[model samples]
Target: MRIMAFDYGTKRIGVAVTDPLQIIATGLDTVHPLQIIDFLKRYMQTEQVERFVVGEPKQMDNTPSQSAMHVKGFVNLLKKTFPAIPVEMMDERFTSKMASATIAQSGMGKKARQNKELVDNISAVILLQSWMDRKIY
Candidate 1:
């Protein structure tokens, strides 16, 4: 079964998917918040997703961040829409920063590094990879 990951945001949601063997996580795309469910519906037609890993925003003090409320609402909707697929929340602290650093290290040009979509996509990859690593070892 394939596992999917989402980095949810008010403006954009980052998407990632694992291979059939569930070994590697790869960034899929960045979609608008309003279109996320529809996007998933279309994607699910072709891919068999067993579970969803959603990034949960948390403050350094272990409290939910302001953005966490939005993520929670989204998660609720996801559960309502896709009851069969389990949804798991993973801490997303520092993922954006890590994505920025990764982009900087990549060979992409300055303009590409500044793209919010790229950051979101990379952040989704980081979120999924973190979950996979935890699950594996």
Candidate 2:
């Protein structure tokens, strides 16, 4: 079984998946918000997903961020749609900045680094990896 992660946004949702061994998290793709459920359904047909890790936005002092309400709504929909799969939330503060730094260090082209979708995908990877690390140690 594999684990999946999502960085939910109004326009696009970043997706990531763990290796079968649950060791490494890789960026999967960015899907439109409207298509996330359908995309997951189609993906699940081929891959056995064990759990869903969703990025939860929080304020610096630990209060829910403005975007947290939207994420909570999406999490509700995810639980409703995939009752068998457990859902988890991981704090997502600074993930976007981390992703941007990662992209810069990778020496990706300026245009690619500037792509919001790419940032989202990397952020999802960061979020999933953080969760996996926490679980391991």
Candidate 3:
């Protein structure tokens, strides 16, 4: 079975997927928030995703941020839409900063770095990897 992860934001949703064996996590794409549910529906049909791990934003003091509530709403929607699949939350802190640094360190040109969507997608990959490392053997 494969697991899917989402780094949800107001503007975009970054997606990542684990291998069927649940070993590797790879970035998929960044999609507009309005389109995320439709995107998941199409992708899940083909990939047979078994679970969803969503990144939940939290403050430095480990308190849930306002965005965490938004994420919770999204998770609730996911459960309603795909009741058969289990949904889990992963704490996401500094993931966007990490993604920005990795992009800068890659020596990409300004034009490429200006693509916010790319950074979101990379952050989603990192989020998924972190979640897997924390929970999986």
Candidate 4:
């Protein structure tokens, strides 16, 4: 089974997944907020998801960011819809900026770097990788 991560935003939700061995995280896709459940349902039909990691937006003061309020419903829905799968939250500060910098350093053209969907997808990947890096043993 693989672990999945979500970088949730009001308009779009980014998706990423780790391999069954949980060594590497890969960008999966970006889907509309309303479609996340359906998307996961379809994805789970083919892939066995072991757990979910969600990006929790935070402010400089270490308090929950305004966007965190918006993510509550999405988190609730995930737990409700997939009761068996566990959910985790990881700090997501600067992930978008990191993804942008990664895209820039990748030699991607300006137009491709400007794609919000791609940014979101990469942000999810970064979030998942960061979480994995924090794991012990």
Of the candidates shown, which would achieve the greatest lDDT relative to the real structure? 2
Task: Name the weakest run of 10 consecutive residues (lDDT summed) in model 3.
Answer: 108-117
What shift in Å separates residue 47 of candidate 1 from its native position after superposition? Answer: 0.7
Backbone clashes counted, model 4: 0
1-137: candidate 4 lDDT, tens digit per residue:
89999999999999999999999999999999988999999999999999999999999899999999888888899999999999999999999999999999999989878999999999999999999999944
Model 1 per-residue lDDT at 120:
96
Q: Which is better, 3 or 4, measured by TM-score?
A: 4
**Stretches of candidate 3 exceeding 4 Å from the true structure:** none
Q: Which lDDT values do the candidates have, in the order given?
A: 0.95, 0.96, 0.88, 0.95
Candidate 1 per-residue C-alpha lDDT over 55-99 given as tens digits, one digit per residue, 9 for 90 to 100: 999999999999999999999999999999999999999999999
Name the TM-score of candidate 1.
0.97
Task: Give model 1's clash tally.
Answer: 0
The positional error of residue 131 in candidate 1, measured at the CA in angstroms, is 0.1
Ranked candidates (TM-score, high to low): 2, 1, 4, 3
Alpha carbon lDDT at 77, candidate 2: 97
Q: Write the per-residue lDDT of candidate 2 for residues 46-91, one digit (tens) a residue.
A: 9999999999999999999999999999999999999999999999
**Clashing residue pairs in candidate 1, if any?**
none
lDDT of 4: 0.95
Q: Please give the distance, in angstroms, between residue 75's alpha carbon in candidate 4 and its true position after superposition.
A: 0.7
Name model 2 segments beyond 4 Å from true: none
